[model samples]
Target: MRWVALTAVAPVAWGANYYVTHEFLPPDSPFYGAALRALPAGLVLLGLCRQRPRGAWWWRSAVLGLLNVSVFFVLVYAASQLLPTSIASTVMAVSPLAMMLIAWTLVAERPGIAHLAGAAIGLGGVCLTLLTGTAGVSMPGVLASVAAMLVSSFGHILTKRWNAGTDVLASTAWQLTAGGLFLLLVAAAVEGPPPSLSTSALLAFGYVTLVATALAFAAWFIGLRYLPAGTVGLVGLLNPVTGVLLGTAVAGEVLTVQQLCGLALVLAGVVLGQPTRAGRRGGSRTPLQPAPDKSAAREFSTRNPL
Candidate 1:
């Protein structure tokens, strides 16, 4: 419960990322924007953690970093450029479904029918809330967003696989540093000259680095450690909800009746996906890993028992 609550913080920050990027950040240099968001936060975190990846983890850290942070951020930012935040986010709503399949395959979790139903409902609700009846979407942007969701799903599973009993902070720091460096080189090569920042842009970048990348990723790893992959993915639908609410509250946009109803459905979907205790007599807990599984624990003991 505590980890779930902590993980929920990431969505709101991610919601703010869309708004800040669209409203304030440079549109043309997504690579640079991505690099800026990642590298600084990573360096700061690495400084604090003071732990280095050893042996196989060095490559594993790099792979996870590229999949989760560097490449994912660039793709997401590019999608935000071409698609409405709503459209991009709605596309991301499918993550729960994707994670369900991946988690079942990887971790051997058998979430009941309710979990699948919840994913479908949450995805539909996201569509209803954010679609806005737009007929045309940029094909490239849509593809990028969907690809982003897919890669991130895999990344989440990988995180769970490698995470086991590792220090969330140190692991996150390693991935960030590796991904940050990779993106920095790409940003330098393709992005050309860096854009000058106004005060607001600097502040927004600061917020992105601190809240969105640093704090959010930390909480995300914590959530992955505690919750099942599918549940964490389901909770991700809240990102779109936060984006929608932020639009209405901060951007002065008004919500329609359909959108309100859709929000309700999204909430219901999240609840439905959660594990519920069966009857008291011979009561059995539904599939949920409140902590690492046995294999994961063994891996931790063998790899790093310090």
Candidate 2:
């Protein structure tokens, strides 16, 4: 139940990301915004944790950081600049599909027909939502966004597979720290000095760093501890759904009848794809072993005292 609540929090935070980026950050300098958002948040989290991950954990952290933070943020921000939020988000809606493919290939975890059909139907709704909007879509932007989402999806699956037994807070802190350092380097080389700060930009930065990066990821990791990778992936559809609805209601973006139909389809598909408690017990699923208890922590310290 705690995990379910934690998982539910991730999409709401992610949905707000679009609003922050679009309304607050300067459209011309996306990489700069990405860097500001990721690096600072990572540093803060790392400082708070103060435990350096060692050996293979370092490599694991770096890999997760690159996929989840560096690539995902940069590509999504750049794509947003080139395309409408709706179109960019619609492309991102394909992440569940990518996650499904990765799980089946890597873990031999297959979804039932209902899951597949629901994902397809939801994707169709996303397409309709994009088509109904008045803004012209950019093919390059759409492709980039889709690619970024696929990469992020893979990272999420890897987190479930590799870090299932690690402390959620510690594992997340390491990934964010490493990923943030990488982004800082990218920003220095590509974007030069950060842009002049504005109040709205600062707010956006804080929201991205503190709320989106720190809190959102904490919740996400906790949720993944309980849910299947594919189920968690499907929940990502809410990110775009919330973005579109908020864009329309708050930003006064137009929503046509087609978009309404699309929203309905997406909602229906998500409902159909959700896993019931009974299914979780009886279904052929990957077992997510919980992290070690306090006794194991004590044993590790006693065995390898620094």
Candidate 3:
């Protein structure tokens, strides 16, 4: 339950991030924006952890970095710029299903009946909230958001698979640092110089870097360390919930009674998917457990932790 609460922090921070990016950050410089957000946050965590990737972790970190940070960040930035905060965040709610399927295939964590049902209920709520018909939807933004969801879902499950014995902070820092540096190089080549920042933009970047990227990723990975991927993904339902409420409160988006009801359903789904003590005991082992088999890949991963 404490892990559930801590995991909730990531999506909530990410939810607020949509509004901040849409309202304050430079829209035309997504590459630079992503690079800036990831790099500083990575450096901060690296400073704290004071450890670098060793052995196969170097390549693993690079791959996860590309999927989770480099590409996903740019797509999310594009979606945030092109769509309303509520809509952009709602699109991401579909990631629970995606994560479930990916986890089933990649890590052999079968989706429980409760998890599937919760995803269904949560997705239905997403539709109800998203179909407000008040704001015009952008097709490109929707595509970008969906792409971000799939990429992130796969990357996150892969993180869980390989992060068995690693310090979550160190591994997260490595991915962010690798991804940020890659983005920086690419942004320099394609986007020209980094964009100039206004005072508001700098402040927005600070919040995005420290809170959303660094703290959120650490909390999220920590949850993955303890909980099943399906459970963590369902907890992510709060991302859109926060986006919708924040949109209503700060962005003056309409909060219909229907949307409020949808919020209830979404929260219910989140609650439904939480791990009971019985569930934890009866279900497949989380990544924190050592594998029973002495497979080469398992042995290799064990030898080169994180």
Candidate 4:
């Protein structure tokens, strides 16, 4: 339950992202917003941890940073502009299947019936909860959304497969910093000068940086470190659920009967998909082995063995 809650925190905070992005943050500035949300939080965490990338992790963090954070955020923002939240979110709902397949292939972790069914139920619930009428979806938006799912799923599996030697906090901070730095350059080139943020925008950025980006990523990484990737992927369903519920509660949107039913299905799916001590069967995984790089290899072997 504690692990489940930790995984849930990421999507819950992200669910609120819909509200904050729409209501408070500066419009037409996804890059800047993403950079702001990530870079500072990463810096603060890195400062506290005072942990540098160990050996091969220098390259590994850059790769993970780009896929998990940089490109993922950029594509999400792009999809939002091109498609409705329902469309973008429902597309993303397929990530659990992707994560499962990747996990199976990479680590030979077989999916249990409960998790498989839960994924289907949760995905259906998400569709029911979010999609209604037709969306003005763009081709680019569809591509971006699909790409986001693929990239993030692969990145997550890699996070599980080739984990870092550092503590969860420092590992997460390193990736965020790398991703954030990349975004700073991209946002400058593509978006040009940063837009002036409103008071509300500033406040929204603060919440996203500290609570959403910093704390949320910490919980997410912890989940990835400890829980099965499929379970973590299922928890992502909570993002749209959170957004839909928040819309009803905070944005004066009407909640339909279908939405309520969908939420229930999502809950059921989550419950079914949860990882338990009884459920966790030992699976084949590649162990982290040491190499010539004493710092990185030793850290990977001793600290982050699969």
Candidate 5:
């Protein structure tokens, strides 16, 4: 449950990010936007972890970085620019089922019936929340959002499969840093120069980098370390829930009674899919271990004194 709560932070921050990016960030230069967000956040986390990738982690970091950070961030930015907050987040709501399927295939984590039901109910709620004929839909935006979902599902599950006994912070930092560097090179080549930032844009990037990217990914990876992928995915239903409420509160969008019901259903799905005590004991096949070095072990203990 503690892990569930921590995991919930990622989706909530991401939900708010759709609104922030759509409203404040530059719309045109997604590569620069993604690079800026990933690099700064990666550097901050790397500063804390003070560890570099080892052996397979070097290539693993690059692969996960490309899938999870570079391409994922760019596509998400494009989708946020092209779609409304609620709609964009609702599209992402499908990730729970996707993650479950990918985890089953990639990591042998079979989905429980409860998880399947929760996914169905949660997805139905997301539909009810967004299928109202009020917002205009973009096919390209939908494609981008769907692409982001698939890429992230595969990347995250691959992380789970490969990250057995690895330090979450250090590995996450490596992925982010590698991805950020990749994005910077690509952005330089294609986008000519970085976009100018207004004060609002700077603040927006700060929030996106620190809260949404760094804190959110850390919390999310922590959850993946401790919980089943299906459970973590169900918790992610909060992304759309937060997006809808944020839209109503901040964007002056009206919250229909149907959306309220959808929110309830989403919450219900999340709660329903929580791992029981027995499940938690048995479901997590991999046990966490030290970071394969005395210095990293000391740093991890120093930083996480819990």
Candidate 6:
């Protein structure tokens, strides 16, 4: 489906994020990268969308951006400075579990036993992956990463809840713009003057802005419009998986058998968390019902398959 394809593109773009941050950007400049990546992209997207949000949509967009992008990026980049990318990513792997919990509490959307079990298994795998590291994990780094993921998860759940009546493009543009401004403020206060931007750093910034943030989020909204929320959440597991593989293949990072097992468990969890024919009965369904024409459905489905 169109949604599926669009959603699928997100993880692929995100997979390259670690490398772009670690290798391309200068050390201790993650915040700088975050600022550059978000602000311009936000502006571009906002210009393109050119639609104003009404009423509570503006407040919701700001809140979502603060949680999902500004705060999340700060914690993640800071944690990455102190922790290995793999470890940071492993910590992020718990996002689905967090989103599931939030959905249950706020929306009364109970996760089935399979979803819970899979989340538990996936979390365990994440723990194993973290434990396998010899470089002693910093407590602050662990806490920061976990906090980042939790906030990001909350943002995701909020987005799902709000997207029902909102204009996706307008919501996204506002959120990104808000997040960008917050990041810029942080960068100005905490990081002071930007470092001498190198060519690689510039490229990384461009990639993050154009590809990771803008394109990926656009794709995500498209996918969310068609898929079940849980399915969309579960598909996020691919993010770290692709990150790990790319880290190994491109960055020459080592992967032990335990880590491989962890990957397998994560994949298993994703599969188990997916909606079966029965499980899709209850949940927040997208209102933009597919057209009756099979060709229209097929085209839309190709871009956004559930």
Q: TM-score: which candidate is best? A: 3
lDDT of each: 0.78, 0.74, 0.88, 0.76, 0.87, 0.72
Over 4 Å off, model 4:
80-90, 134-143, 281-297, 300-306
Q: Give the alpha carbon lDDT tens digit for every residue of 13-76 in model 2.
A: 7777776677778887766777777778777766766667765777888999998988888887
For candidate 4, which ten residues in a row score worst on lDDT? 283-292
Give per-residue CA lDDT, model 3, range 73-172, as digits (tens): 9999999999988889989999999999998898888878788888999998988987877657899999999999999999999998888767788889
Candidate 2 backbone clash number: 0
Q: Candidate 2 vs candidate 3: which has greater lDDT?
A: 3
Candidate 2: worst 10 consecutive residues by lDDT?
A: 297-306
> What's model 4's TM-score?
0.87
- Which stretches of model 3 miss by more than 4 angstroms? 281-306
Encode model 1's per-residue lDDT on 150-253: one tens digit a residue. Answer: 99888978887777666678788888888888988988898778778889989999999999999999888788776777667778888878777776777665
Best by lDDT: 3
User: RMSD for each model, in Å, please?
Assistant: 3.5, 3.9, 3.0, 3.8, 3.4, 5.6
Query: What TM-score fits each model?
Result: 0.88, 0.89, 0.93, 0.87, 0.92, 0.85
Candidate 5: where is the Cα deviation over 4 Å? 280-306
> Which model is ahead, 4 or 5, in terms of TM-score?
5
Error of model 3, residue 47, in angstroms: 0.6
- Candidate 4 lDDT over 46-84, as tens digits, reads 897777886778998899999888998878767765654
Comparing 1 and 3 by lDDT, which wins? 3
Better of 1 and 5 by TM-score: 5
Taking all chains together, the TM-score of candidate 6 against the true structure is 0.85
2 or 4, greater by TM-score: 2
User: Order of all candidates by lDDT, from best down to worst?
Assistant: 3, 5, 1, 4, 2, 6
* Candidate 1 regions with alpha-carbon error over 4 angstroms: 135-137, 252-254, 277-306
What ordering of candidates by TM-score runs from best to worst? 3, 5, 2, 1, 4, 6
Comparison by TM-score, 2 against 3, better one: 3
| Model 5: residue 228 alpha-carbon error in angstroms | 0.3
